[model samples]
Target: MKVLLYAEATRLISKSGIGTAYRHQIEALSRVGVDFTQDWEDVYDIAHVNTVGPGAKNVVRHCKNKGIPVIWHVHTTPEDIKNSFVFSNFYAKLSRRSLTRKYAQADHLIFPTQYTESVIRRHGVKVPGTVISNGVDTQIFRQNLCKAREFRERFSLNGPIVLGVGFPFKRKGIQDFVEVASKMKDVTFIWFGAKILALLPKDIRRILRDPPQNMIFPGFIPQEELIGAYSAADIFFFPSYEENEGIVVLEALSCECPVVVRDIPVYKGWLENGVNCLKGRSNDEFEQIIRTLLKDRDLSEKIATNGRMVALERDLSVIGDSLLKTYEAVLGRCRS
Candidate 1:
């Protein structure tokens, strides 16, 4: 069956998680051998809308009116929108209202994680939803010695390197990351992301100006370079307060980099603490975990091996099969 993969604001979100997620959908669909198109006017049997912009609302309406099944991928919820930009929290209520109305128009909903599904339900979304991982490309994101060396040489990263991905935002626990890095002057902390400087709040802008000597903000780097960063990092420290499902975490796991994340609800069922990854409640705990991982190579290797297995389970091929099944089921119900 043919499918329409649609996402609005492609250029604007090209550097964001939502953009990465949409690309993953394309990869997953291709692996499953599904015929799909991004052309808005292209005739298709099903529509998988990945964004909630005004353009997407019109697309959903058009699809529903034509009796075509619409799968609305819930990548953004009001809960995770706060602390992203100036007055981000102030716009959350409006975002909720808009999101709920658009989501209600879909024939079905797709969430990147079960936690995302639960949150959308709480926001008054009555539509049936399914949880599918954003998935990772194990082949591309896996560890590579050549790339690792390149990353270190390019960035001049010395000693044990700690890496963090995603834009610096308060909700992402950027403040906490800075504080943690400040306390650990011996280990180099590198954050790879690019955010619009003017859109940032005063506090975030202020901190970015005078970050500790050990900290490096390389802005955004190419995907090839990012793979190297993952390979070279001793630990992937993600202190984000919330996430639907972190694509970067999956990439780190695939690279067999031991991950330390905040004890957030989104990772409840998966990301077992001390097994595949470490979980910390605060900056102090995060620092302690990083220190332990640095000293205990055995423990680091154990978790790294386990984390790779977890990533394998969410590989693009596996995600492709699951997505194909879901698409067929939705179409089958429509036929009946």
Candidate 2:
């Protein structure tokens, strides 16, 4: 079946999880022999809209009017939007109402996590939806010793490295990351992600300007280099307050890097504390987890190994099959 994969503002979200998800979806759908098009004008059997912007809403409306099946992908919610960037919190309430209206136009909905689906339901989005992860390309994110060594040398990094990857936003737990780094002055703390200087909040901007001695903000490295960073790091620490689904955690797992993430609902079934990953409830807990992982090589290796297995289960190939099935099911309902 032909599918129109639509996501407004692709360039704007290119460095974001949404953009990465779109790219991975396109690759996976193609591999599974699903004919798809990004062009709005192209004739297609279904519309898989990923964003809820003006253009996206128009597409959803157009598809409904044309009797075409529309699958809306839920990548954001009001709960996750607050404190994400400048003015995000201010606009979050309105976004919820807007999102509810837009999602209502879909024939079916897709959520990256069950927790996200629950959030939407709480916000009064009653549309039928299912949970599906934004899978990672294991080959691209897996360990690369050569690249890792080169990356460490290029950045002059020494000693154990704790890393995080995401945009420099307050909701991403940037302040907490900095606080953790200050306590662990012996280890190198590198954050690889975009830094939108103009849009940063005052407190975040101040912290960026006068970062801790051990903290390194290598803003926006290439994907290959990012993969290397994951391989080089002894531990991947993500203290984000929220996420629809933390794709970077999966990528770090693919690289066999032991991950320590905030104990959030989104990662309920995805990450198991003390099994595939370590979950921290606060900055103190995060620091303690990092220290434990640093001192215990066997535990780190065991977690990394198990994490890789988890990553494999959510590989692009597996996700593609799930997407195909979901599409067929949606179409069947439409016909009925």
Writing each residue's lDDT as its tens digit, candidate 1 over 1-336 gives 999999999999999999998999899989989999998688999999998888898888888788899999999999899888989999986888888888988888999999999999988889887899999999999999999999999988779999999989888888999999999999999988896789899999888888899999878998999999999999999999989999999999999999999999999898999999999998899999999999999999999999999999999999999888889999998889
Candidate 1 Cα misplacement greater than 4 A, ranges: none
Which 10-residue window in model 1 sums to the lowest lDDT?
A: 190-199
RMSD of each: 0.8, 0.8
The lDDT of each candidate is 0.92, 0.91
Candidate 1, number of clashes: 0
Worst 10 residues of 2 by lDDT: 96-105
Error of 2 at 262 (Å): 0.7
Taking all chains together, the TM-score of candidate 2 against the true structure is 0.99
Residue 2 lDDT in candidate 2 = 96
- Residue 246, model 1: lDDT of 93
Candidate 2 Cα outliers beyond 4 Å, as residue runs = none
